[model samples]
Each structure stands twice: as C-alpha cells, then as structure tokens.
Target: WAIGLLEVAFSRYCPITFGIRTMGLMGLAYAHYSFWPIWSIPIMVYAFLPQLALASGISIFPKISEPGFLLYLFLFLGAYGQDCLDFLLEGGTFRKWWNDQRIWLIRGLSCHLFGTLEYLLKSLGISAFGFNVTSKVVDDEQSKIYSQEMLDFGVPSPMFVTLAVAAIVNFFSFSFGFLQMICGSDDNEGLPLQMLLAGFIMLNCWPVYEAMVLRTDKGKMPTKVTIIAAFLAWTLYAAAFHISFSK
Candidate 1:
C-alpha cells in the first residue's frame, strides 16, 4: 500500500515524460505486431532485455559470458537501429537522420529532466500547478512568424523555468564534482558516476539552456516564471546543502 502511494506520487510529479516515451514505444510495437508480425519477436526482446538488465542489475543472468552481454547490448541498440534502417529505406540520408537525432535527443532529455525537477518540487510541496495542454497540430505560418520574431519555442510555463534552473545547477554540480575527483579529494568516492550522469543530463538539456538564455524564441522562459523557478531552485539547493552537510 505504501509503495503504491509512492508510485502515485511519483507519477503525479513527472506525469508525461516517461508516459510519452512509453506511449511512443507502445505504438511502435503495435505497428510491428499489426503489419510485421515476424519482426515482433526481436522487437519485444530488444525492448524488454535492457529493462530486465537494469531492474536486476544483470543479476538475473549473473554468470552470463561476455559474449552474452555483448549480444544483449546489440539487441538494445537494435531498437534505435531499426529506426535508422527505416529512415534509410524511406529515402532519407543517414547524415540527415543522424543530425535530426541530436535535436530529438535535446528535446526529449530536456522535457524529462525538467519534468523530473517539477515532480521533485511537487513531492516536497514546494510547487503546484494544473494541467498544461500540449498541442499536436503545428502551424507552419505561425512557426515561421515566431522564427522570424525570434520568439520562444513552446508555451511559457513553469516547466521551462525549472529546466533552466536545473541546467545551471547540474552544470556547476558536475564541474565541482569533476574537479574534486581530478584533485584526488578524499571524499570523492561516488562523485565520478554522479558527475558523469549529471554531465550527460546537462548535455541533453542544451535545448532548455538555449531557450532560456541563448535564444529569443517564442518558447523562451517568461520573466514571472523565471522568478518563481529561481526561488524554487534556491529552496531546493538549500535543502540539499543542509541534508548533505548536516550528515
């Protein structure tokens, strides 16, 4: 019961990030099952194996040989490998698709990371908000206009503000952690992995950073949202400092 409650709380906090990905993956699976049943087996295996490995920390196949692990890794790559192949078959150049992937990765990671911070704040009772609509339709003319005006990219929401704060915080956190490790600090035991993950998260959050500070797009962070997010960010930072140092 307690676990279920925790799950509900988590879901509420980062509502759409993983949900959107899961839905996309599910739709892909459904398409494969409907039109190309034979490929479904490999697709399912590729999708599930990495998750199993993560959940069990590879303990489920503890004695697996290196070759077995490599095979699993290849299968994991197959998920995206299939997409690349599809793009090629559809007359898309590899270079173009590869370039496009960078944009997609930025958008995806930014959304997920920002949503995560929003969720954390919500769980701590520091932030609260209602539903925000995500539109499916794109208006080419409006996009052109916004692009011409150098306006922000999407809706002006607290999410972007949170993302901006997170990007800055993670950037500094990673830098300090990396410096500590390089200087061979005594307390740098788990800092490497933490710093690496933080760096990766920030790398994928370039879009947010650009939207918030670099670009004048229609999707840029609004002043009011920025102020609110800055306050929340400071609150979180203080709480983390207290928790880490008080111990």
Candidate 2:
C-alpha cells in the first residue's frame, strides 16, 4: 500500500497526492490484515517469480466494484435494452421504473447476496426508483457455492502489530486529511506536500523484524493495543516529516 502511495505522489500529481495508487496499496494492506495466506502467498510468489506475478490479488475483489463499475458496465448497460424488454416492465412513472430497477437488481442478485451486499453496505441514501421485480420465482436450493474468506485479515498476523495499526491510521489520516485540505479551504496550505510525502514514506519504511518475529506473532497482541501503536506511528511520522521539510 505504501509503495502505491509513493508511486502516486511521484507520478500522478493530484490535488490530493497519492490518491489512486494508495488505493492499490491499501488493498494490499487490507489483504495482509484480513487474509493471511492470500496476501502472503502472492508475495511469496512474487518473491520467487519477480517477473510476472504481482502481489495484487488482495485488490482483485475490491477494485472490481462500483468505481471499477465503469469498465464492464458499458458492456452490460448496453444490455439494459434487453433488460428493459426482457427484464424491466411496468412500475408506474419513470421514477417508479428506476426504483423498481434497484429492487429487481437487488433481488436478482439474491443468488449472490454477498456480492450484492458489498454494494448495498457501501451505498448510503442510495434508495432509488428503477427496475423493481414484483414477482420472481427462483429456487436457491441448488445454487452453486464457493468458499468464504477465512475471517478478518488480522487473525493471522496478530503479533506486535504496530505496523498494521500504523498502516490503517495512516491511510485514513492522510486520505481524509488530504481530502479536507482540498475540499475545505478553511486552512488549506497548498496540499501539505511534505506531510503527504512523510505519510507515503512511513507507510513503507519500518524496522526490520526477524522472520521469526513475523511468523510467531499470530494474533498475539490485542486489536486495541495495536490500534493505539498504529496512530502513534502516523502522528510521529507526519510531525517529523513536516518539521524537517518545513521552510
């Protein structure tokens, strides 16, 4: 995640630095937190191959959503015509049709409630009028099922997890803080480039822990304990960063 932020800061000079690339890195971190072998295996693979493999599997599910919705939606939205003739019908007014569309999309997605829930949970005040399915009969008894994620990403690497906590805190701190600096001119200081630089650097720079420590620290520390340590890292990192860089 840190690497991504740095890349963005270096290349994609947005008003808020490291916006897009940090997204990739954050996904990597989340995988490290929520899925142990998932992220680790990819890293191991990348370590070995170092050529073709990218440790981006953690980002697969995440990047394939609403924002990424644009990519495939063009292909599917075209099918909306078929959706109208074959899928959507009478709701009442155009607004009614739109609301109906939402309900139908939700219900048709019953087969994959988990994926559907992914969209629903993130969307707030999102109720709308579109395609609504009045009566739908579909048997879920024979639905094909795959495995579920083991658990939260933290279960595996639970030891001395100051780094993980620091990552999360740094993510929100820099991400939101940058947003604030951009959106609200209350105290805007031209992007705080130095603070952003610190955040990106601190994200990747950490003490070298022996392999034994990393392997042994399986859910050893409490979540709360690590959370505190994480924020401290960010605070110290950002403060030291701006202090050194300030003119």
TM-score of each: 0.47, 0.23
What pairs collide in candidate 1?
A: 150-216, 151-217, 151-218, 152-217, 152-218, 152-219, 152-220, 153-218, 153-219, 154-219
- After superposition, the stretches of candidate 1 with alpha carbons farther than 4 Å from their true spots are 1-142, 145-154
lDDT score of residue 222 within candidate 1: 68
What is the Cα-based lDDT of residue 232 in candidate 1?
A: 63
| RMSD each, Å | 11.7, 22.0
- What is the per-residue lDDT of model 2 for residues 39-134, given as tens digits with 9 covering 90 to 100? 333322221221111111011211223454354445445654556654345434544454455333322222222223333433444653333333
On residues 1-247, what C-alpha lDDT tens digit does candidate 1 reach at each position?
A: 2222234434532223443466755544443322222332332232233222222222233122435645544664675689889989999988667656545443333444344445556668886444456776657855774566433545765435545665666666666666666788665543433454456557656665666667664566666766766676566566656655566
**94 in model 2: Cα distance from truth in Å?**
34
How does residue 122 of candidate 1 score in lDDT? 66
Scored by TM-score, the top model is 1
